[model samples]
Target: MQERPPFKTLFAVPLHCEGCISSVTNALSQVEGILSVECHLEHQLVEVEGTAAPSKISKSLQDIGKDCILRGSGNANSAAVCILETHAPNVENPVRGLARLVQAGPEFTIFDISLKGLQPGIYQASIRQNGDISNGAASTGGVWEEDTRGTEARGRLGQIEVDSEGSGGIILDISVAIWELIGRSMVLSPGTELFRQDDEATLVGVIARSAGIWENDKVVCSCSGKTVWEERVEQTGKGML
Candidate 1:
């Protein structure tokens, strides 16, 4: 049998001196399944080559007082890209942006979102139950919906601030199980928004889906893709139409 290649992960650290470099390198080396640890002091980055669980490696570094940011990893592969769309198609001007989700660790995912051509202000972000980007549609429900407008905020993603140039960026650290969010969509409301009870008033839309769902190397939803509703039926044996 051919030997599998070792996993590699690059992390950004705060190494200021040789001692700090030595400490980080030694600590990572001690972790089980770690084949090698290389520190680049000039860049304050450490590269670990091994088969260790990413979460375990991060915890080991934290144990030694080394705070690290994951730059990239062999184990970190699942991700999705989304193009933000406006809810109202007839509106003369619309919000435009892109968002990406990447698996950061075993229990956490990172959401990197950027927006342009938006009104400069604060907006509320949340994950909704539908990946529908259409002007009007009904959702086949399989996920939790804590209604923020009427009852409570179920999947609150906090607020994002658009700057003077109508551009904004935010990185979200979500602790929810990533698999649960696979088929949902992200929605951004206009203004310093409160939980909106009306669906027609939403400003932006982007489907949150697995990176694997694509056609001809392009990600799209045109009634020809594997849908969240299908997954729900398979899991629960309940046909969703």
Candidate 2:
């Protein structure tokens, strides 16, 4: 397997003093696949460059009692995100998973995905041809085709095995471009089959552009009048892991 190149990910952390910086750096340094760690006490930001999943980094910080939020990732115009949701009427909270895609190089992209509130079983993920989720994954069309050669579906992102607690995640290096996936839809369907349609347990979300490093600096949301941490609480309350 080809080694994945390192990419930068910035996070807004609560840094009060130099000790905080040292602690954050130490925690991240211990994480596997992390190449470098830089903490800015003045800006209260932590910048990590490596092949580590952002979620893993965040969890490490959280384990040390530090609250951190991902501010940006990748390079300009090279990052995207998706919120995988189930549109089944019987399901109260539709959200079931999340996906983050960042272009690590000219020939490949890094895909970090997480799932929660799902049954303990195997599931498959894929990028569909359309962005529509009107009928959940059923409306998203087929898996994205790389070309007309009828070759393998480059958008098939592979399997995720949920634990008994209904959570699972993975970081993958795939041969696809961030630009090619914009405006598409990502589906997480229960089973090992790659082309299964939407079911009650299926989760779907649209691919949307996400901020790159230093691109988003707002600490407060303009529409909600809530700080970033406050927004995080709200999202957490909504079952976003």
RMSD for all candidates, in order, please: 14.3, 1.5
lDDT of each residue in 8-60, candidate 1, tens digit only: 66666778999998888888888887999888888667888775555556668
Task: Give lDDT tens digits, candidate 2, residues 109-135.
Answer: 888999988999998888889998898
lDDT of each: 0.60, 0.88
Q: What's the TM-score of each model vs. the native?
A: 0.49, 0.95
- Deviation in angstroms for 192 in model 2? 2.3
Evaluated with lDDT, which candidate comes out highest? Answer: 2
Score residue 110 of candidate 2 by CA lDDT. Answer: 85
lDDT of 1: 0.60
Which candidate should be chosen as best, given TM-score against the real structure?
Answer: 2
